[model samples]
Target: MLHLITYKYNFIPAGEQALHIVFPEQINISENQLIQELASQLRDSYEDEITDIAPAYRTLTVYFDIRKTNYFKFSNKLKKFLVNYTLEKKNTYGRTFEIPVCYDLEFGIDLADVASFGKLSIPELIEIHSSTRYFIYMMGFLPGFAFMGNVPDQIAMARLEVPRSSIAPGSVAIAGKQAGIYPVASPGGWRILGRTPVTLYTPDNPLPPFQAGDSIKFKQITRADYEAIKELDAHGEYQLKVL
Candidate 1:
């Protein structure tokens, strides 16, 4: 028996050529996965009409060619598609990446503050943060910035009240239940926990290796290890490990 996936969702016009399929507001793995799957299916099913599809935490923004399909026709098609959509159970899991992060004071400026907030030792805080394989709910803000989630409640710090002028690339951060990395040396604010040595983005190759629906696991490393990996990555000799 085919189990039809059903969830409450609504369509909202973004512009003349685009529209958003919005789901319930929440950061959830199952919901995000559904959005990702829907995006994939839409691309495959309506490739001629769709120019791009971006999946976020609980929304999929679809950009279609106005010449090929108007909002009313496209939305009606999407409604029909949703009525028959069923997810492939076997392909539920996304790719998993093991990224290295160093929680040294110089890189993690807000580390002590987060630890204090959680009433945990720095080591304990690092342990909790690194233990979980965070799910990638979306990728935005920068080319390689992945919005991942469900930071352990013990250290789920909120974002800084004042935005930072600039944030270094590879900075690992947490905001409430979300975790993320700075892909380049530009930012507003998110509580910094550590920094990764891997080069997340480069001008030559703007697109990231991973995509939304993937998973990221941060491995705690020493400062020396961070420097070593940084050198290797800069020279293009290092590759991020994926599981």
Candidate 2:
């Protein structure tokens, strides 16, 4: 149900200019879209005060200028406005991102383990992961980390017992039913199958290259292609070119 209650919050003191609250339920893809939409509304109205809106698995934190924006007042306004915030089941938008995966034995470090767990051949594992389409649920844990969903039923697997020291960027890894890209080089536990050429995170770029509610389609590439892409990246001209 959509919330209509004019939330009266003493949660903020007079001196406080900003506030943050965590919701009880973990937010999935569509729910995040709603939070962003609501924040967009506030942004349109009070461009100066509402500095930014961040969405997570189950919560949204809004940042604003306390000197320019009243914390309690803005909270009450949002509560009342979102009473009709499209609570009904809605559709997730857009075309599928055909991300190319270089699944040569070298890149797919955990391909054998995944095949063993699923009782499938290595070729079978690659076939399954590439054929399926996934929906992005959230973007967090790190910048541009697209928490996409619904790996093939047969391909579902658990994270490694211990996280890796560092996963290569563009690594398409699956932990439980959720899968994600490394975005930037970082430590993770997800069973990495292959690396993509996609540049998921770039600091100099304005706005992240991705957003909530995007689709993903994995395609296979070769070791040579991976090396070529790596070389391009070394020269700082990286771009995901599907083969």
Q: Which candidate ranks first by TM-score, i.e. highest?
A: 1
Q: 79 in model 1: Cα distance from truth in Å?
A: 0.9
Clashes of each: 0, 4
Among these predictions, the greatest lDDT belongs to: 1
lDDT of 2 at 150: 73
lDDT tens digits by residue: candidate 2, 109-132: 999999998899999999999888
**Tens-digit lDDT string for candidate 1 (1-243):** 223345788999999999999999998888888788778889999999999999999889999999999999999999888888887543355888999999999999999999999999999999999999898889888888999988988899899999899999899999999999998988667999899999888889887788887899999999999999999998999998998
Cα RMSD, each candidate? 1.6, 4.3
> What are the Cα lDDT values of the candidates?
0.89, 0.71
Model 1: weakest 10-residue lDDT segment is 1-10
- TM-score per prediction, in order, is 0.95, 0.77
Query: Residue 76's C-alpha lDDT in candidate 1?
Result: 97
lDDT of 2: 0.71
